[model samples]
Target: MSELNHVPRRPLIAAFLSLCCGPLGQLYAGRGKRSVTLAVVTLVLMIVAAPIALWIPGGHVSFKLLMFAFACWPVFLIVDAFQCARKARQQRLHWYQRWWLYPLVFLAYLGPVSLISELRTVFIAEAFLIPTGSMHPTITPGDRILVNKLGSRDDVIDYGNVVVYYSKGPGSPLYVTRVVALEGDTIEIRDESVFVNGKQISEPYAAFDGELPTYPNMVSMQPVVVPPRHFFALSDSRRRSMDSRMLGPVPIDYFQGVASRIFWSRPRQIDFSVSPENSQIGAIAWERIGMPIR
Candidate 1:
């Protein structure tokens, strides 16, 4: 009788691999078919969950709950992997269970995931930290936001959309402002009020300082038509904003994206304790998190 050719499988190592990548533990346990199925199922569920959550009211909370459940998926995989490893340790080794093949498979899986992540960050959406209170009342300093990179086109942009665009030059830093007028529309500003196409537009999000206004000349403008492929933008905090009235109409190509949501925020201070003025400083602003931008 031929002697059995058994290869040892360490349960701890299998669990660790599963924790790193959900399907990796199953693969290490010599259950290649199960590994593939689990990976596929996880991917499909995540893809489906996003849109479903967005369709519901207060979807950000629902989305977070769904993600928390998804996060626990690896824990289940880890337990299964540990059991599989213990059971398979004394069994005859399969032809595909080569020691070096595990690393190769891990690398193969990692490559595509990394590529997709990079592509999404570049073209789909990216996060940014607000550096100034120019858009004050609506968006404040220390706010971390997600910007939709696909809304740069003229057809997709409209009044009231908060946008990130380059000013001065293409190489200059990005500026965040709200669209006040679109191409071919006549726009004017009267002190703190804004007029578009001969009508005063309501701007509930705008902020004005009672003391005075910087660039006060910018607070008022003679009606001017926005040129083709150009649009006018203004900051919500008109008192301190340097926008279209100062930089002129922005070209369509200058836009980067539309500000989508405030994902996180905190007071920008050294100490995260109660301030001398009794205001909470350096602490996370919970109310701002997951807030959608108009």
Candidate 2:
């Protein structure tokens, strides 16, 4: 058999390091292009994935595409790190050159979740998982939604608009509710009718069963006074929801922002995983791939 041609140590080292953490080992072996590209990509991905991991509510990625990207990063990092070390020793590169791999490995510990949070939060895009069916038919269980952190408008809170606001106080999960009434509007509920400003507020979005008030307190619009800068809210699923009825009206300060859209929707299984590792961004419903929120 013919002898295989000899490959250079530098190329071998670069290839190996790139696998562990991308071109890092090759840089130690004195390859500029190889090292820089790996570093840049790793940093870019770390920045992107970190935020998604941090605040994408329940620590799950709302966007399937993003989660897919996040899952592959660490594998690349470990492979590249290994390759870089191999090349340096073979090529007899200087000590400091090989040491760069140490910090790069430390970065691997930062994990994809942390990196996504740090980078995405800088851009003001926050996302969280929908944990309940209160906003059903609009937002379902296990749906991931994108929230505009700085897009909340107080005086502009219009009726029938679905909003994410603090329904419980400073220490509760931000809820998604439809605005039913504005300040001093004389809101009232009876049987299944809603009267505001001495006129009924039209609620087509409210579920039929939810069309009426199901206040846990059974106050039935107990002649409540909605303070200024406060807005009355209700669950879209009226009969099944517990909103301003039980908790009272939500204040402008309690308003977080509007529910923008459903970024990703999956089957109703909290913390669900299809596979053993559940590492991959598995099958998604084709009809809802990019369906916009109403």
Candidate 3:
């Protein structure tokens, strides 16, 4: 046997590569076939599991189980890669084993997985943290909520649904607000009261600090007609919200999804107009946890 074949593979490098890029570690350990197989399996599992998980009824425990399975793919790959590298280091290799085909196989396997992951983020549900009181009363600061990326795609986004959308500028944070008006609807706000299509719409969930009305801003003139493929959103706490009144109507393409539910909530000094001056201990807002956002 050649001297090169007698040398042990570097398990640490393999592990690190796996951590950085899925299945790359297998290639590093000269296991091209294993790397390709693992990558293909991981991608297939993720692609198949995501829609199944999302389709499961939200109330069922199996939904969470499926989601857990989808999320564990990365962990599974990492651990398997580490173990494969460790075992490969223990075994003597033939000179022919370390071939250029390994890296090519790794790249071939990685491309599809990366593409699927990106598509999943765009078309599936994703978690988001509420960092401001812009959507207060419906969503609070420190609350973790799930955004259903497929919500609007599958069904018509109706009035009064809370939606998560992208901001206009590059690198802008996602904004969550209530859909008050849809395409072709006429919207007007008088003395903080919302009127849609010439009728006053009752909003029981709307929060107001006092008798203060919606401030006169750039978009707060006589009835504004919502354009085609656009929506008007407002904060539940209207007095403090910087929503469509300030940002203008949001295009349909900008929408990410509708806010589904509060998965977690922590009691912090929320920046609402009526927040308490001091934070409290054991401050988890238990009532808000698992509360579905309407």
- Residue runs of model 2 more than 4 Å from their true location after superposition: 1-100, 108-123, 152-156, 209-223, 269-284
Stretches of model 1 off by over 4 angstroms after superposition: 1-4, 42-56, 73-87, 168-170, 209-211, 269-281
Q: What is the lDDT of residue 101 in candidate 2?
A: 57
Q: Write the per-residue lDDT of candidate 2 for residues 51-160, one digit (tens) a residue.
A: 35434442222455556766676566556655555554544444335354547653763465476665465354567787666776777666777665544476448787
Compared to the true structure, candidate 2 yields what TM-score?
Answer: 0.62
Model-by-model lDDT, in order?
0.77, 0.61, 0.73
The window of 10 residues in a row where model 3 has the poorest summed lDDT is 271-280
Give the clash total for candidate 3: 0
TM-score of each: 0.80, 0.62, 0.68
Tell me which of candidates 1 and 3 scores higher on TM-score.
Answer: 1
Model 3 lDDT tens row, 102-136: 56656776678778878887787677877776677
Candidate 2, poorest ten consecutive residues by summed lDDT: 271-280
Worst ten in a row by lDDT for model 1 = 269-278
Q: Model 1 scores what on Cα lDDT? A: 0.77
Between prediction 2 and prediction 3, the one with superior lDDT is 3
